[model samples]
Target chain A: MKFHWFAEVTYGHTTAEEVKNNHTWVDAPATMHDPLKVGKTYQMFIRLMQLADRSNFDGLAVNEHHQTSFAMSPSPNLIAASVAGTTENAAILIIGDSLALYNPPTRIAEEMAYLDCLSEGRVIAGFVYGTPMDSTFCYGVPPVELRDRFREARELILKAWESPEPFAFNGKYNKLRYVNLWPRPVQKPRPPIWVPGSGSVETWDLVIDEDYCYGHLSFSGLRSAKPVVDGFWDYVDQRGGDTNPNRMAFTQICCVAETDEQAEKDYAEAVNYFYSRQNVNPAFAQPPGYRTVKSIAHDIEMRGASSLSNEDRMRAARGEMSFWEYDEKGYIIAGTPERVRQRIRELATDLRIGQLIPTLHMGNLSEELAAKNTQLFGTEVIPYLRDLWADQPDHWTPAVSQQRVNANMPQVAGVAGN
Target chain B: MPLTTQTVDDAQIRVWSAGSGSPLLFLHGFEQHPGDAPFLQRLAQSHSVYAPELPGYGESTGFESIHDIFDMAMRFRRLVEHLGTGPVDVIGHCLGGMIAGEFAATSPHLVRKLVLVDAWGLWIDADQPADPFVLNPEQLKQAKWHDVAAAERETSIAQSHPDGANAAMLLRQQNLGVATKFMWPIADRGLSRRLPYVSTPTLIVHGESDGLIPSAYADEFARLLPNAEVARISGAGHLPQVEREDAFITAVETFLAK
Candidate 1:
C-alpha cells in the first residue's frame, strides 16, 4: 500500500465559539483570521511535509479550495512547488488544480511540466472539476458548463504536452492560435493523472475510460465512504474495466500516539475542531446542475442504505460524538499504532484501496502534535502495511519517487521492509 | 390553451398556443413556464399567443444545440418561421426578458414590438442585483413579491401536471440549470451593447419593488434601447404580471397597439 501525507491546511487559531457562529466555507468572514498567522500556518505545513518526506511517506498530497478556512489552499500548485523543490523522495501529489477555473489551460500544462521537471519526474498531475462552491459560486463559472470546460481544458493540456511542434487549436471555450509548451514534462507522456470525485458515476466512467487513478477524497471516514467506494468498484468491474487495486485512492483522517489514551487526549479537541468548523451553508453545498439527475438519484438510493445515519453524520459534523464514537463510525482512525494499523488494514483490504491519503493534521492541531502523528505513522505504521498490496503494481504515482521511497523505508521490528 | 410539440432546426420543442388576431410570442420567466396562466389566456383573446418552452426547459429537446444567446435567438427565429408567422410582437419576463432582448437585437426584422418585464440582461455595478439562485424559499418570497403573504398564491412552478412531485422538482432543477447559461453570477451577457441595435419599439416594464432586479436596471435598459419607454408597476416585485395582473396586461397591450 502507498501512503500519502495530507492535511486540510486548516487555520489553527479559530476558536470554538467563532466556528459555531459562522459557516466555514465560500462566504466565511476573512476578518476572523490574521494574515501573519496564515503565513505562519503555511510555514508550519511546509515544515510538517518536509518531516513527512524524511520519514518515508510515499507522496505529499495538496489540494485546492477557495474562500474557505476549512482548507485555506486557493492555489495548490504554489504549495506543490514548495514541496517539489524541497522534498527528494515523495511525489508532489497535487490532488489537484481545478481545471475549469484556469483560463487557457495551457497555463496548467506549463505549470505541471515545470513541477515535473523541478522534481525530476516526481509529479502526479491531478485534474479536477472543483467544488460547486469554488467553481460556480467563488470563481463564477456556470455550473452547467463546468464539466464541458474541464474536458476541453484536459484535452488541450494533454495535446499541448504531447504535440511535438506548435499547433493551432480551436475549442469552444478557448482558441489559441499558437499552442506550444516550452518546458515539457519529465515523464515520457506527461505525469500520471489522478481525478478525485464524490461518487458520481460520470466520474467513475471518466477515470475508467481514461485509465486515470480515481480518488475518493472525503474525510467522512470508512462508513461514509464504503457504499460509494464499493459502488465504484462494482461499476468498474461490470464495465470490464481494470480491477487493479492500485487505481483507487481514499482519504482518511488519522491520529496516532504512544497509547490509545494519549491519542484521544491529543486529538479529541482538534478532531472536534475539524468537524465543527466545516459547517457549510446547505444552500451553497449543492447548486442546481452541480450533480446530474441520475447521479442525484443514485446518491439518494445509496445513502438510504448507508451504515452512517443522518443523525450520526450530523452529530459527527457538530462534534457532539465522543472520540471513540467518531472512531467507531469511521469518521476517524485514532489510537496507538497497533489499533490504527488494524483499523486501516481492515479499511484498505475491504475497500481495496491502494493509495491512502492520510490527513495527519486537522483543525487547531498544534504543530508539535501533527509532526509527531506524521512521524509515528510514517515510521511505525507504513512499514508494516507495505506488504498489504505489494503484489499489485501501482502505475498511479511517478516511477522515481516510488523506487526512492521503497529503497529508503525504515526496517520495522520482525517485518521485512519494502 | 393547447400544448403541442413543434419541430424546429431538427429538434422538438413544447409550445403552448391559443387565440386569434396578429401573432404574439410570450416567453416565460426563469422559473418554469407559467403554464396556462390567466394573463396568458387573457392575452390570447386579443392576439394569437405562441409561448414555447425554451429549449432544455420542461420537456423541450434542443438545449444541447444552443451554445449562447445568439443560438437561442436563432432557435426562436426558426420556431417563429415554422409557425408561419412574420414579425410577431414579443413579450419576455425575467430570464425570458434577457433572451427576448437578445432576440430583438439580433433579429430586428422578426420582432415588431418588444416588452421586457423585470428583465435581467444588464449589470449596473453600484446597483448590483441580488443572486436569484442562492435565495431560499423565504428569502425568494421576500425578494420576488411586494406582499410576502401573497407569494403563496404564486403558481409559476406549482401548476398541476401529469408527472408527480419528484418529476416537478427535477423539471424545476432542469429549467434553472439552463437559466444559469445566461443568468449565473451576473445576468449581463453584453446585452447593453446590443440594445442600441434593436430597431423594434420596446417597452421596459419593471416592478417598483423588485429586489432581484432594481428599478434602475429598467431605466438603464430604456436608456440603451434606440426606441423604448418605461412603465413601473406599483405593489409588485419581480413578477408584476402575477402581482398586478391588470396593470401589467394594460401596459403590454397599450404598448403593442402603438
Candidate 2:
C-alpha cells in the first residue's frame, strides 16, 4: 500500500459557533474568514508537506473546494505548483481539478504538464465532476450538463497532452479552433488519472471503462463506506473490469502519537472540531438534477435497505460520537503508532485499498501537532504496510517518485506485515 | 383534458391539450408542467389549448440530443411547426417564458402574439434576480408567491401522472434537470439579443412581489422587444396567473383582443 500525506487545508481558525450560524460550503459566509490567516494557513501547510516529503511519504495530496471556509483551496493546481516546486520525492497528487468548470479545458493540461516539469514528472491528474455545491452552485455548471462537460474536458485534456500537432477540436460544451500543448507532460502519454466519486453508477462506469484509479474520498470511515466500497468491487468484478486493489484509493483520518493515551490527549479536541464544524444546509448539499434518477434509484437499492440511518451520520458530524466510538466506527484511526498501523492494515486489507490518503491535519489543529502526526505516520506506520500489497504493481503513480521513495525506504525486518 | 404524446423530429414529447377555438399554445413554468391546473383550464375555455411538456420533461424524451440553448430553440420551433394548425397565440411562464421567447424570436411567422408571465431571460446588474436553484423549499415557496398558502392550489405533472410508484419523483427530476440547460448559471441565454427580432406584439406580465425575478426584469424585457407591454399584478409573486388569475386573465385577454 502507498502512503500519501493529505489534508483539506481548512481555514483552521473557523469556530464551531460560526459553523452553527452559517453553512460550511457553497454560500458559506465569506465575512467570517480572514485573508491574513488564510495566507498564513497555506504557508504553514507548505512547510508541513515539505516535512512529509522528507519523512518518506510516497505522495502528498491536495483537493479543490470552492466558496467554503472549511476548505480554502479553490485551485489544487496552484497548491500542487507550490508542493511540486518545493518537494522532491512525493507525487503531487491533485485529487483534482473540476474538469467541467474550466474554459478551453487545455488549461489543465498546460498547468499539470508545467507541474510535471517543475517536479521532474511526479503529478497524478485527478479528473472530477466536482461536488454539487462546487460545480453547480458556485461555478454554475448545470447539473445535467456536468457529466457531458466533464467527458468533453477529459478527452480534450488527454489529447492536448499527447497530440503532437495542433488540431481543430469541436465538442458540445467546448469548441477549440486550434488545440496544442506548449509544455507537454514529462510522462510519455500523460499523467496517471484518479477520479473520485460519491457512489454514482455513471462515475463507476467511467473509471472502470477507462481503467483510471477510482477514489471513494469520504471523510466518513469504514462503517459508512463499507457498502459503497463493496458495491464498487462487486460491480467491477461483475463487469470483469480490472479488480486490482491498486486501482482503488481511499481517504481516512489518522491521529498517531507515542502512546494510545497520548494520542487521545493530543487529537481529541481537533477531532471533535474537525467532525463537528462542517454544517451544510440541506438545500445547498443537493440540487435538482445533481444526481440522476437512475443513480438515485441505485443509491436506494444499495443503501435504502441498509442498517445505518441518518441519525448515525448526524451524531458523528455533531461531535456527539465519543473519541473511542469514532475509532470503533472507523471514522478515524487513532492512538499509538502500533494501534493506528494495525487498524490501517485491517482497513486496507478489508477494503482492498492500495492507495491510502491519511489526512494528518484537520480542523483547528496546531501546526506542531499536525507535523508530528505526519512524521510519526510516515516513519512508524508506513514501512510495515509495504509488505501487504508489495506484490502488486501500482501504475497510478509516476515511476520516478515511486523509485525515489523506495530507494530511501527504511530497511525494517520485523515490521513487514506483522 | 387528456395527456397525449407527439413525435417531433423523432423525439417523443408528452403533451396536454383541451378546449377549442383559435389555436393557443401554453408553455408551463420552470418547476413543472402545471398539468390540468385551474389557470390552464381557464385558458383552455377561450381557445384550443395545446400544452406540450418540453422534451426531457416528464415522460418527454430527447434531452440527450439537445446541446445548448440554440438547439433548445430549434426544438421548440420544430414542435410549434408540428403542433399548430395556424399561427398560434403563445403564453409562456417562468422557464417556459424564456423558451417561448426564443421560439417566437426564431420563427415569428409561427406566432401571432406572445404573452410572457414572470419570465426569465434578462439579467439586471444592480437588482439581480434571486437564484431559484439555491432556495430551499420554504424559501422557494415564499419567493414564488406573495402568500405562501397559494402553493396548495398549484398542481404539477406529478399530480396528473400516476403511472408508476416513483413516477412523480422521477418525472419532476427530469423536468427540472432539463431546465438547468437554460437556467443553471444565470437564466439569460442571449435571448435578449433575439428579442428585438420578434416582430409579434408581446405582453410581459409580472407578479408585483416576485422575489425570484423582480418586476425590474419585466421592464428590462419590455425595453428589449420591438413592441411590448408590461402588467404588474398586485398581491402576487412569481406566478401571477396562479396568484391573481382574474387580473392576469383580464390583462392578457384585453391585450390579445387588441
What TM value does chain B of candidate 2 have? 0.94
Docking class of 1: medium
Task: Candidate 1: give the TM-score of chain A.
Answer: 0.98
Give per-residue CA lDDT, model 1, range A1-418, as digits (tens): 9999999989888777887798778889898899999999999999999999999899999999999998999999999999899989999999899999898899999999999999999999999999989999999988878888898999999999999999988999999999989899999888999999998899999999999999999878888888999999999999999889889999999999999999999999999998887768887887887777668777877787688999998988889999899999998999998888888899999999999999999999999999999999998899989888889888999999999998998766754322
User: What TM-score would every model get versus the actual structure?
Assistant: 0.97, 0.96
Error of 1 at A140 (Å): 0.5
Q: How much does candidate 2 score in TM-score?
A: 0.96
Clash count (model 1, backbone only) = 0
Chain A TM-score from candidate 2: 0.98
Off by over 4 Å in 1: A411-418, B156-165
lDDT of 2: 0.88
lDDT of 2 at B217: 90
RMSD of 2: 2.0
Whole-model Cα lDDT per candidate?
A: 0.89, 0.88
